[model samples]
Target chain A: DAGVTQSPTHLIKTRGQQVTLRCSPKSGHDTVSWYQQALGQGPQFIFQYYEEEERQRGNFPDRFSGHQFPNYSSELNVNALLLGDSALYLCASSPGGWNEKLFFGSGTQLSVL
Target chain B: DQQVKQNSPSLSVQEGRISILNCDYTNSMFDYFLWYKKYPAEGPTFLISISSIKDKNEDGRFTVFLNKSAKHLSLHIVPSQPGDSAVYFCAATYNTDKLIFGTGTRLQVFP
Candidate 1:
């Protein structure tokens, strides 16, 4: 079975520009969550989507947004990128609700210059 | 403030020794805890988890112990191998999809 998949394994964007990262959840998963991992640091939860609606969010600001499609695929959008925004964007998928085993993608590495 | 914390930024152990990684959380309401191991340039991979209801959970050579009273948890690896060396992260959640993570500890197993 196919696991979670992410696109554009690497990206480069300048400040004041917008970037979009895509993710497809693993088979049989119904939820998708986004996380950002800074160098030498653990990942921080960004947001989660279920049923195409954002069910929960973290401490991130309005500059960070996401979307979940009908097929359980997700996209993370960031506006006005900052140097601090340079991190590995991870997409995790779960079977259903919270506390379930999460399947993670390789992640999209974003370099905000 | 970090809800979850891993005090050790890195650790080294001789292969075949018992390696213990510790984690703590400030939130008493966190009901679920998980451990993830990551290799360089790769995403974190789920290792093992412990629910609040259970004090201990074991899988293969790995074990996790949870102490609800202290808001602490630990992961134990027996006869650790060199391949076991990786960055380990502790995560916790309170019945929500959001998981709070620690800074992570890099484990190095030396033969």
Candidate 2:
């Protein structure tokens, strides 16, 4: 009955540093997706992972990368973080494809200084 | 290129009134549209969705109307309650695994 769980509710990082955000999908869910939401903006899709492989990606740059493990857990990594990288990183879980209703985690607030 | 646009940044309505939130998209290929309700610190919750095949879908007091020709969609909430006040996000997908979201509209239902 537990929903998606995220680690390190809030984080602070300096410029040029690499940061990793973790997510554990809800029970019985197998797909994981990553999204970035800047202040006053809606969540933007970064990538989606299914069957332990990336199935689709958005218009994000190379610096933003993700990995899906066998357990349906996922991680989002951002390298050379810039000040603009400070935003809320959200992880969503679905039962199957993109069309399914996505259940989201509270999100990890990343602050890049 | 912002494919999805919610021109109104915010909307306010009185209790027991009807509140409508509008959304438009430029991509004609998008066939699936959805709405999400979000609080200040919480992640968005799925409100409702409509596929290309349907022009309208209703669930309780919330309804979604899709005008395919105009590439526009709207969410209507009746007898608005204060608890319904939150940021509403419009999202679209083209039968793919990715969704394009709009800037979102903040709705405030007053007493």
Q: How would you encode candidate 2's per-residue C-alpha lDDT over B41-77 as one tens digit per residue?
A: 7889999999989999999999999999999999999
Name the top TM-score candidate: 2
Candidate 2: which pairs clash? none
Report the alpha-carbon TM-score of model 2 versus the true structure. 0.97
What would the per-residue lDDT of candidate 1 be over residues A1-113, giving only the tens digit for each residue? 98999998999999989999999998999899999998878899899999999988889999999999999999999999999999999999997755456788999999988
Q: List, for all models, the DockQ compared with the true complex.
A: 0.70, 0.72
Best-performing candidate as measured by DockQ: 2
How would you encode candidate 2's per-residue C-alpha lDDT over A1-113 as one tens digit per residue?
Answer: 99999987999999999999999999999999999999988899999999999888888999999999999999999999999999999999998765457999999999988
Q: In model 2, how many backbone clashes occur?
A: 0
